[model samples]
Target: MRLSTNQVFNSHVSSYNKGYAELSKTHQQLTTGVRIQTPADDPVGSARLLQLEQQANLLGQYKANMTDATNSLTQEESILKSMINVAQRARDLAGHAGNGAYNDHNRQAIAAELKQIENELFGLMNSKNASGEYWFSGSQSGIQPYVRNADGTYSYQGDHSQQYLQVATGTQISISDNGFDAFESAKNVSRTETRLDTAGPNGQRLYLSQGTVATQRDFDGGFRAGAPYRLEISGDAATGNISYEVYDKNNVLVPAQDGGVGSYDPTLENPKISFLGVEFTLDAMLKDGESESDYATLLDGHSFEIGMAPDRFATVGSSASAQITDSTVVDADAYAAGFPAGGVTLTYDGAAYQAFAQPGNAPIPSTFDGVSNTLTVAGVEFSFSGAPVAGDQFSISADSQENQNILNTIAQLRQALEQPADGIEGGNLRIREAIATALGNIDSGMMQIESTQAHIGARLNSIDTLTLENESLSVYNASTQSLIRDTDIAEATSRLVLQQTKLEAAQAAFMRVSQLSLFDRM
Candidate 1:
C-alpha cells in the first residue's frame, strides 16, 4: 500500500486535536466543578444522573412529610400536656370536695371550677390543626365534633373513621381516631328497668275481704308465730270488691290500691287481693261455709293465702327510678327494704360500674381510697357486679388511642359525679375516680406524642442522608459526562498549526519529485 504525505499529516492532526481537547476538557471540569455540559458527552452517565435527580426530589418530599409529622406531634403533645394540668386540677377539686369538712356550698364551688375545666377540655377535644381541620374529629375534621345539646348532653357529629397521614413508603399513620373510641363509648350511667308491672313486685302477699273490713291474718288464724301465716279474702256478693296497698320495707306506699273508696261486704266470696308475690282469696277462708260463709265465687274462685307476703320488692324511689337518668332519686327506705340487704346491683355501662345502697346513717363516707366492687358493711362486701370500687367513688377511664384522649373517662366521671349518695355508698368516691382517669389519659397521650416525634425525627434523618447521597452521585455522574464529550481548545489549536505545516511540506515534496524524474524521461 502506498502512503501519501497528505494522509500522514491528516492522521497526526487528528491525534493532536483529540489530545488538546482532552486536556482542555479536564481543565474545564476542574473549573466548573461539573463534568457534563451536555447529554451527548456521556449518554449513559446522563441517564444515571437523571435517575439520581429524581431520587433526590423524592427524598426532599419525604423530608417535607417528616417535618409535617414532627409539627403534628409537637402540637398534640402540647395539648396533652395542658390536658394533664387540667386533670390535675380536677383531681385536686374532687379531693377537696371529698373531705367531710366541706359543705354542699364547698362542693358546688369545686363543681363550678370543674365545669370550667370541662369546658376547656371540650375545647381541647375539638381543637383544630394548622390546616384548619379539627385534630380529634377523625374523618370529619372539617366539622365541629361535639356540641352541647339543649338538655346539657353532648352530641357528637364527627364520623367514626380515622384520619390517616402518609409518613413513610406504604406506611400511613392515623392522625385521628373516632370520638366514639375515646369518649362516646365510655359512660358510667345509672340504669333502670324499662319493664315495670302495675301489680306489686317481688311477689309477697296475703289478704282478703273479711266481715266488714278485710283483716290480714295467718292461713288458719292460729298458726306458728315463728313463720309468716297466709290469709285469704272472700266476698259474699258478686259485686263485692276489695283492695290493699303494697308498702316498702319503710312502710311507704309505692302504689295505691283504692279500687273503690269504702264498700261493705260481709263474707265477700273470694275477695282476692294480690299483694307481695302471692294472691289471697277470701273463698279459702270460708270454703267450708260456702253460701253460709257469705263467699261467692270470684272471677277465679281461687283462695288467696297471705303468709310473710311472698317478696313483693316494692318500689323505693319516686316514679323516676323506672327510667334511666343521672338525677333520678331512689327512695332511701324503699330502696333498702327492696334489697336483700339494702343496695343496688350494677350493670356495665361499657365504662365503670357503680353501686347504689339504701341510705345509711349520715356518718362520714370513708376518707381512704381502695378498688373493690362490693361495698363493705361491717367488713363484709355486699354483692355487686363489675370492676371493684375502692371507696364510695370509682373511676372508669377511657383507653382510646384517638379523640380528645379523655372523652370516655370524662363521660364516665360526669355521670358518676352527678349521682346522689343516697342509694350509693360513698358516692363522692366516683367523682374522684373521674378525675383520676382523665389525668391518667392526659399523661399517657402526652408520652405517646413525644414518642411519635422521636420516631419522625429518625425518619427525617434518613431522608437527609438519602438526599446527600443523591447529591454526591449527581456530581460524579456529571464529571463522567465531561470526560466523554468536552472540547479541548489547546489541542484543537495545535492540530490546526501542524496540519498547515504538513500541507505546505507535502506540496513542496511533490513538486520537486515531479520536476526531476518525469520531465527528463519525457
Candidate 2:
C-alpha cells in the first residue's frame, strides 16, 4: 500500500505524543502518590474515591459534633453539681435556724445568709457556656433562664425546648435543659392556713393543737368541707355576763348543747368554756386583777375566727374526745371516718341522739343503754357510766395537706427569725413553724437537683459512645479511600520507566524512518 510522507510523519508524531503522555501521567502518580489525578485518569476508581472522601468528611463533622455536645454537657454537669451543694447547704442552715433557742435576732442573721445563697443559686441556674449561650435556657440559649421578680420571687423565663446536637447520622443528643423543670417548677407539697379575722380582738386569738376547723356545712345541717367558722362572744353590761355562739362563713348558727349557748364558767382554774364542737382551757387567761365582769367587757363584741392551719393535713383517720360526764368510752376514729368532709355534730337527746355526716347525706342514730352505758352509731361506740346530759354534743372533722415549696419555706423561716420565740403572744409557735417549713423545702430542692443531675450524666455517656463510633467510622473510611485512590509506589515507578523507554524508541524510529525517505537519500 502506498503511504504519503505527510501521513508517515504524522503517525510517528502521534506515537511519540502518546508515549510521552503515559510517561508524564506515571511520573505524576509517583510524585503525588495518588493513583488518579483527575476523572480522566481512571473514571471508575476516581468516582469511588470521591464517594469515600465525602464519607470521611462527614465522619469528621460527626466528631466535631461530639466535641461540641460533650463540652455543653460538661458545663451543665458542673453547674448542677454546684447547685446540689448549694441546696444541701441551705438545708443544713434551715436545720440550724429551726432551733427553738435561736431568738428573733439570731434567726434574722440566718436569713441574711440564706438570701445570699438564693442569689447564688439564681446565678448558677442562669449560667452561660463558652459561646455565651445560656446552659439551662433550652433552645433559647440567647435568653436568660431565670428572672427575679420585684416581689423577691423567681420566675423561669426560658421555654422547655431542649437544645440538641447531631452527633451522627439519625442520632441527635440533648445539649441543654430548660430552667423551669430544673428549678422553678419542681414539685412541692401542699400548704394551707388557719388565720384569724383582722377585725377581731388582736390578742384574744385561739390556736388548736389537734383539731381542724370545719370549713363548710350542708344546708340539711350536715358538715361541709372548706367551711369557715367563727366563735362570736357577746356581752350585756346589765347582766355583767358574756356568751359564745358558733357561726359558719355565711353567719348561720351552728347547733350546740342546750340551744348552742356556750356554758361559760367563771371559775379561774379548770374553767371549762364549752361551745360548738371544741373546748378551750383558760391556760393563758385574763391579765392579773381581772374579774369576770372585766373579761366580759373586754370581749364584748369580738369574735374568735378558725380556719385551716398550715401544718394540718387531710387524713382518713383523726381522733377527738369530749369531756364525758361519766365513765364513757368514745371511738372517735370510726365516728370521724363516717363524718362529712368538714365535720359532723353528735347531739344527745337524753336517751338517744342523732349524728349527721352532711346536710343531705344521712342521719346516724345512737341510743344510750343505761346498763352498758354504750351507744353504737356508724361503727362508733360511745359508752357512758352515768346518765348523760340531754344537751351534750361533740364535733369532729377531716383535714387537708399543705402545699410547700423552697421559696415559701425560706420565707417562712425568715419570718420566724424576725419574730423569735419570746415567752409572749405565741412567738414560740411562729418560730417552730418557720423551722419546720424551711427544712422541708430544702429537702425538696435537693431531690429535684439530684434528679436533674442523673439526666445530665446519661446524656454525657451517650456523647461518649457516639464519639467512639465517629472515630471508628472515620478510620474505616480513610482506609477504604486509601485502597481506592492511593498510589502503589512500586507499580507506579515500574510504569514510569517503561513509558520513558517507549517514548525514546518512538523518537529513534521516527528519525530513521524520516531519513529513509527518497529525498533524504538524494
Per residue, candidate 2 scores C-alpha lDDT tens digits across 186-278 of: 433323233444322435533322222122122114323324666566666677676777676787787764233564544443344433333
**Clash counts for the predictions, in order:** 51, 18
TM-scores for candidates 1 onward, in order: 0.42, 0.60
lDDT of 1 at 189: 19
User: What is the alpha-carbon lDDT for the whole of candidate 1?
Assistant: 0.45
What lDDT is reached at residue 469 by model 2? 81
Steric clash count of candidate 1: 51
Best by lDDT: 2
Model 1 alpha-carbon drift over 4 Å, by segment: 1-27, 175-522
lDDT per residue for candidate 1 within 1-522, as digits (tens), equals 975667766765675576566656655654565667668767886787677666556655655665666567567657755766776676566556556555445556666776787789789768888889987667878989876532344556677787655644566555554555545543221110111122122121222321111222421232212223222222335554543333333334433342211222434433444332222222222223344323233312232222221111212221211212222223335333433343333322334333444344222121112353333322223233334323323211111122333433444445545555433332433344344444444444444444544554565565456556645655675565455545455664565566556555656764674355445878
